[model samples]
Target: MTNLKIALIGNPNVGKTSLFNALTGMNQRVGNYPGITVERKVGNFSLNNQTQATIIDLPGVYSINPTSTDEEVALQVFFDQTNKDYPDVVVVVAEAENLKRNLLLFLQIRDLGFPTLLCINMADQMQKKGISIDIPALEKKLNTKIVLTSTRQQEGIDQLKSEILALVNAPTTSPFDIKTINPEYFSAIEKNFPTIPPFKVWMALTQNFFSTEIPLDKIEHFRQNHSIDVKKIQHKEVVKRYQFINEVLKKTYTLDTTKETDVRMKLDRIFTHKIFGYVQFIIILGVIFGAVFELAKFPMDFIEGSFEDLSNWVLDTFPKGKLTDLIANGVLMGLSGVLMFVPQISILFLLIAILEDSGYMSRMVFLMDKIMRPFGLNGKSVIPLVSGTACAIPAIMAARNIENPKERFITMLITPFTTCSARIPIYIIIISVIIPQTYIAGFIPLQALVMVGMYAVGFVVAMLAGKLLSKLLKYKQESYFIIEMPTYKVPIFKNVLLTVYEKVLSYITNAGKIILALSIILWFLGSHGGENYNNAEEIVTQSEAAQTMDKEELEFAIAKYESENSYIGKIGQAIQPIFAPLGYDWKTSIGILTSFAARETFVGTLSTLYNLGDDFEEQETQIIERMKNEKRPDGTPVFGLATGLSLLMFYAFAMQCTSTIAITKKELNSWKWTAYQMFGMTIFAYIMALLVYQLVK
Candidate 1:
């Protein structure tokens, strides 16, 4: 069978992802483009059971002229024919209603001399919007096959696949002449680089970074000899292409303005209102937070209880030994700490997916832009900030969407302040233990309100940090905020499910590895120790306190004594003084140290440490119960309100995740800035936590 490669390219919010999902279904895998953090999504399908086709969903771009890394990646795939992702055919997905605006990108791709097909998406909305296209005429004029697809209705998918197959064997052609923009200048360049396509040469000259067979010094020499005005040439090209697009669209497309309704405009008015927009957003956030805590309760309980039982079963069924102890007390206990919070994480991602699918997220961006601009950010920064709620690794990667270096840098540095799902496990456990389970106004759960407040604190701190960074890192390059408002539609369930599944799975897989390793190590440290640990039984038995204790109480006393002198305990004791100001004991100090690896590991570390001495047959061990009963040497409760709040504030601001730190380095491309971000945020978190504990205590 012949193998064919296809690339899907389009402007943002043009139903491109929806069409990709429809075409590929569950046959897709997401990865990063080599040597870059830009996400690459590839899927496989058989065409007519004869040709095997691999389709790449390229990052969205407005035009061949790139402004951001995302657009640059899209251009590079085409610019370098030797690129692994270079396609045999390109499918330019366009919106049915917004064909005029979408055609600019289509024409640019068409002129690249690829065997391109125009996939007009969202055809189901044509009649509702009173829009109609002459597909045959448009295809003839553009010199390509056109397929009208409605992903929601599953329309034209078979036809699209067939067209893609046919196009693979079709001859490539450039719809517009490059010489049309500047006959004299382009003609000279075409002569100089006769082997290269004139359009590719032009792109290579205009782009800041381009991959090509041509030597860089030669291109620089050519630029120096010709003294070319790149911006002028780019402007002329856009004007020429739009001139051609306007003529083609005017004759082949028609819209009945009278038949269209003002529902969208009215909704936009309400959603974008200055006063009510924020009000609605707050209400939506409340509902999401409420659902996260309330709906996840039953499943969280089930997971926690299930893990408890599994641990007990492992202890009871397996022969008593080190391996059995490791499985029961280390791995299972550690995993349960993070896994029990999956339901809440899943719900958060699900709601975020829905908001994005319905296009309400765009309005939030627009609403927040005014507030953001005064700080170092614009509306585009809102995406990375909002995405940070899921995970900072991808959230930092999402900053690539911002064209300006300054804003993008600030966004990356500050995004970790937003409470990610990793922090959720820590926050939920802490909040539940400290806050009362009561509601305000007889309906709103106070716990949920506190959760929302934690989110608010993170966001507010992020904004302030952005402002300070903007002042510190001076850049004069002005950036405009431009975003397309997609037509609102009922979110596709498949897309939402896929998004939630991918995000939650990513969280588990990434956090699982770190937690597993740390859990076993922690268990070892807590299980065995130096001479002190071995002598713990004798030490406790001979104590005056042991004289009045019964057998059960005496065993408990020995276990406690052993834990205080264990290997992990010695390490924690050495560092306890550093965290003592914040009311942290040796165990809490150990959790804080492990948290630097990943915030979620703090809970798992604590779980593994506390469960090491569990008598599973006599009683079930839960991390929360163990923590609640913990006391300091002086008999004061360890997890008092002051300490709980302090921990929350620390995680809220700290740069804890190693993955996030690595991605930040990659995105910023400077260890200087990365160090500044890491140490600065951690120091700030420490001070804030210290202040909170002192004031509240």
Candidate 2:
């Protein structure tokens, strides 16, 4: 019974997450709040091994006034005591080096009358920046307990835990006067709802104009009767809060400007510059793609080789049967498809986490806001677009922060156009075959440049599509962009590595399950067949060409013939003509068709098809090498330059992932809009593939 739920809240980049990772370690799971797309992370840790506690890491927000739905969720918990997540105590995390800016949200939380403990994170950076805070004076002035902790150095953690455990009840009185923030509105609301807290009443009214929750019908009616100026009251409340925060800071906080000039400012000058910022961003992307290609190849090859050996061992150990084929060809092949690319995915996530934790990623938003505005997007859109490169599902979910429906919808529509992790495997498989592995300047790999070029193609197409959609879906809402530029520091290796591990694990576990199931189903379909398939041996042996072949070659021909007559091959052949103009044969057509459910299924499908009767192996051939050896009846490679490029173009444009479509439907709440996005991209993909194949051939 000795249990409590604590909510940790703060502005972004305040090392709040670092502290959470430190406190919870591996005891965390991510989920969503009920009836909302906003992500919620809950973790549990025992205090002193006596009292158990649940800590919810709420989404980061700048203030209580909710512009986006994520911020609304944050404020909703504080405003509505009836809500399930009303915390027992709040831990408001602030940046010690940037206490003044961090204090705004803290003050807002304190006003809500929750038992709040102020955690000044990044205390290790305070002395380096020559910033000093009178912790005792600040606690006394703000009427709260303060803990100066450093997640980096593991400082003040015990002190923070002891303080958090000891705290029991929230203070009865508000930190600042609620009536002082606009007497007319407060007095009016308080007069009617005398029993309810005035601060809660005010919040319910202000957010009611935006939120769908109907906590107080009286407050909604009362606000309508009074004809409240929502924006005007919001502005007045911010001004009043800052006035109080400034007075408190003047007494307890000081910064010496004489220290070494902030290197962050120097970096910002170029990093946020209009022209230079974009140039640097492109350079950084090229480096990331280059690292993904050249650096990950070693581990990727090892993984592929190891799996191939395992598959061969499974066949060698077990008598050939239906179960053995399913285990070796279906299950192991699916697992390999999932895991072989972990090195590349982990590398990309690691580099991205470093940029994000180091605070350089914010500059990207600033630089992009300029170009994004004309396309009906702002700095916030930069997040979903960039995250889309990793996966479109979460990226679309992240787009909830856009506030503008038109812009958010457009961002959602084009987000899938970005080359997701699924596409990375497909790209690697094809590019390694067609693009020569020559080094550029003997440093950068030529294949890496091609990878980056593919990403560039996706981004450019997404942006152009964004511009086109913006024009078609014009709206009158004005958008305001305000993002804080956190002080840059060396990225914490622990945090970065943890992020990479979690994300890469998620990719394998979540995507792997689907791949495994599909792989088995594909194997079954490829292995079993009707009269023609059953008669494949009879059909092949009767041919004069079969008599001249060697034993291994004859067996290979029989297996291929049987597979072509099997259920899956017949299905693929049915759609062959549709993709024939795009240079894809029946086998390639099967991969493309199966991939419509999930792009990662592309590799699994091919692996299952090519893995038939693959027991007699001496040197383990890679999936790419197998693909390279594939030929047409006329004695030409199937995956030649024109065909590979065409396939690449098709996948790059195609809206193949059904997970994205489901999320799009959920977010947009309209089948009409989702259909426009789904079928529209598919049509475009087909046309582009057709053009490229025809022109090149």
Candidate 3:
């Protein structure tokens, strides 16, 4: 079968990915570019039995002259001929409402002389907002095929596909004439690179093409070495395109400004209020987190119990062996660990989509900017923080919108500190295990209040970190936060469903792989080792010292010996000395190490290490019993209130998510920052945990 490479490119929030899903269905993978952290989404679909097409969904951008890393990736993928994998055809998805702004990008692609197909998406919104376009005129003027599509309505999708297939077979036609900088300048370039595309020459002259791609030796040796002010030239080009768009719209479209205040604007006025807007935003977010933990409790309980029941059933049915133990104790534990968090994560993202669709998020940035001034964070940085709850990777990506370099960098650094939904399961289990259920103000459970307090600590620490970095970095840029509040329409069900599907799938897929791998590795580490390991050394020694102990006491002592000397026990032993001052035993040490893959794995790791031999719920009960009665070498209880609080504090501040570190490296453009972040966060966590443990103990 012949393979065709096609790219879907457009401005952000243009539903490009949705269209890609509509085309590719479930066969998709979420990956990052080999070197950079930019998301790489590629999928395959059959155009015909004879031809299979591979589709790449490129990052959204405003123009080829890239500013952000994502935009740069898009440009490199499109313009860098050395890549040998450039798309055969570019599908430009443009939002119908923002045609003028969207057209600028489309025109840039067209000028590149590539096989370009224009998709005027969100066509349904156009009619509702009183927008009409002369389709034939647009096609004729742009000299490219146009497909009017409404992804939400599922309109014009088949038409779009047909147009795409036809584009492959249709003979190439040079679209519009390239706009000239000056007649003399163009003529001179035309003479110099006679065989080359005129726009290609212009791109080189303007440095839109990378420095190496331009013939520096040839340029210096010829053409009188005339220097061009390319920045000025590019600005003129933008003006020209806008001028053309203004003219085209005069004939092809009309808008009714008399449409009164849109629901988007009305909602924004309240949600983005200078004072009330921010309070409401905070309260709304508080509700989201609160709801995820409180309201989802029943379902999470059911999932936890179900998994426990399944594990016990397996233990009863299967003959005892290493493989049986691994399956019941490791794989099931890992799967349960990941699956338990799905409900909370899904609800968190659902709230996020609602806020975004209601157009309240953009205004929250504006409202919060004034308040964040005291905390050293740009108000714009809040978006990344808000989104960080879903995943730190995209949250870090969103930080690019902060124009101030120092602010952006600091935001990227601290975003991981925010408790993402991936940590929800870990937090829930640990808090339940540690915190007492007493109420403070007659209603708020002490546990819930502590959860809120942890969030506050994270926010305060992030603010302080941002402020410190802002002062440390000497470079200055005027901080400005301005965003177009998109018109609010009723939240489209399909769009929300698609978003939740993509984000949740990305999380589960990544977490499942890592959790499963780490679980198996941990199981092996905890299962295999030394002759005297998991032996009766402690019990034998105690019995030898005194024959006065009763059999029940001896039996208890033997169980402790077996647990402390188990394969996992020995591994944790070597590291136990490090965290001893923090009131943690060897098992806690193993939990910490295993949790680096994902924080929530801590509870499951402990369950496995203890040989609880039950599912998640049963393990929780066993854990409570074990922790309550566990002893140190001195026979002191392992987890009193002090130790429990210490563990809780440690998780609250620690950088435990490997995916977050991976994203940090990608966003900061170096391992240096990622290293600094991990080290600094770990050290900070250690110090804080030490202080709390020391004071309480």
Candidate 4:
């Protein structure tokens, strides 16, 4: 079988992703490019019985000149011949209505002397918008084959695939001449680098970066020998390319303005309104979050109950031993903590995907820029901040889209302040226990209001942190913001599902690994300890309190006593004093510590600690009920209003999740900044929790 590699390239919002999905359909895998945080998407497909192809979806960019990391990644694949993702053929997807503007990138890629094919996408919209294209004439002018595709309608996809296969064997040639822009400069470049393409050499010189294939010393020598005006040359190059493009487009393309409608403009007017825009965005968020809670409750309960039953079954079916105990009480319990919240996470991703697909997310970014610019962020930062609500790991990675180093760093540092799904379990359990269940004004649930309040607090704190960091961090580059307003359309369900699937799967895999490891380690620590643990039964049985307790109560007391004397118990005891002022007892201290592995593990840790026993009845108990009944040495409740609120405040601001820390280090590529973020957030969290406890208590 013949194997081929294809690079799919396009501008943002050009239906490139939809085409990739339609071509590959569940055969794709997403990861990071070599050493960068920019996402890399690859998929495999079979073109014929004896031929197979691997397609790489390069980061979307406007032109070969790079302004952001995303564009740099895209440029690298084309420039670096030795790159693993370097393609045998390049396919540039272009929007049908915006062919002229899209061709700028297509032309640049074609001029690089690659066998390139232009796939004009969204062809279904051409007639509705009264746009007509002369495909044969355009293809002849551009010196490439053109395939009209509507990924939504599955039109012309087979033709696209066939053209791709044919292009693989086609001869490579440049359609545009670099010497046309500046003959003297190109002649000099060709003289210096005879073996290399002048256009590639020009790109390296103008972009101020070069691939491994180019000799850095030679390029540097040439630059020092010749006085080059990079900006002026870049402007000249753009003008030259567009001059050719406009002439070709005029002969081959036509759009009847009289046949077009102003619906898009009218919709943009309302959606982008200074006053109404913000109001609509807020309402949309409210509905989405409200749906997240309401839609997830039934599935969450089912998952919770199912896990409980499985744990009990493991206890009953397996011989009573350490392994069985670990599986039942440790792994299963911890997995349940995160798995149960999957419904809520999935729902949130589903809604966010729909918003993004429908083009409303861009408007939100545009609207929020006015608010965020006062801080250190731009419209791009809105994406990472909004994404942070789902998971901080990817949220931080999403900050790669922000071109400004200062704003990107600020976005990474402050994004964790937004409430993540990991914190959802923590928030829900705590709110349920402390906040009233009744509704306000006989309509709005007070619990829901508090939940919204928590989200608001995170956003407000993130903004304040951004403002502070903007002043603290020093960078001289001026920030610029430009966003595309994609024509709003019904979200493609396949695309939405794929996005939701990938994100949710990532969330589960990351959280599951940490939770599973910590659960077992926590169970072992809580299961066995020093001499005190071994003598727990004797100590509890002989106590005065045991004298009044029944058999079941006696068993529970002994189990509790043993857990407190266990290794984890001793560790908790050592940390108890530090958190005592914040109203967290030794047991709750254990939960807080385990939560560093994952915030959701707080519930699991408490479950394992409070329910460590051999009694069958005790194994069926719920963590919330046990927590409600818990009391300190003085007979006061451990989870009172003040303590619950304190815990909520701490988790809200604390940098607890290790996954987030690792990704932050990877994205920022600085241990110093990572350490600063970790300790800074943690200390602030402690101070806030302490104050809240003291004031509320």
Question: Which has the greatest TM-score?
Answer: 4
For model 4, how big is the CA root-mean-square deviation? 4.2
Candidate 1 lDDT by residue in tens digits, 1-697: 8889999999888988889889888898776666555667789888887898899998877887776654566568887768888888999999987787888888778766689999999999999898988889998888889999999999999999999988976766776777899999899888888877777777777774454667788788778878778778888888998898888988999999888887889999999999999899868866876676678778988997899899999999999998998999888977886586578668767886899899897888788888889998997787678767766766675576566667877999999999887788788788877898899999999999999999999999999999998888866555667777999889999999987776666556654565566567767887888887989899889999989999877886777676668886677789899999999988788788767767876876676556443332232336666777888889988999999999998999988876676557766757788889989999999999999999999
lDDT of each: 0.81, 0.78, 0.71, 0.83
Cα misplacement distance, residue 295 of candidate 2 (Å)? 2.1
Pairs clashing within candidate 2: none
TM-score for each candidate, following the candidate numbering: 0.84, 0.82, 0.79, 0.87
| Model 3 residue 255 CA deviation in Å | 2.5
Per-residue CA lDDT of model 3 for 18-61, tens digit only, reads 68877887777667665655666788888777878888888767
Instruction: Sort every candidate by TM-score, greatest first.
Output: 4, 1, 2, 3
| Candidate 1 residue pairs that clash | none
User: What residue runs in model 2 are displaced by over 4 Å at the alpha carbon?
Assistant: 35-37, 79-84, 209-215, 259-261, 273-276, 376-457, 471-480, 580-652, 655-679, 691-697
Instruction: Between candidates 1 and 3, name the one with more favorable TM-score.
Output: 1
Best by lDDT: 4
Candidate 1, residue 340: the lDDT equals 69
List the candidate numbers ranked by lDDT, top first: 4, 1, 2, 3
By lDDT, is 2 or 4 better? Answer: 4
Worst 10 residues of 3 by lDDT: 171-180
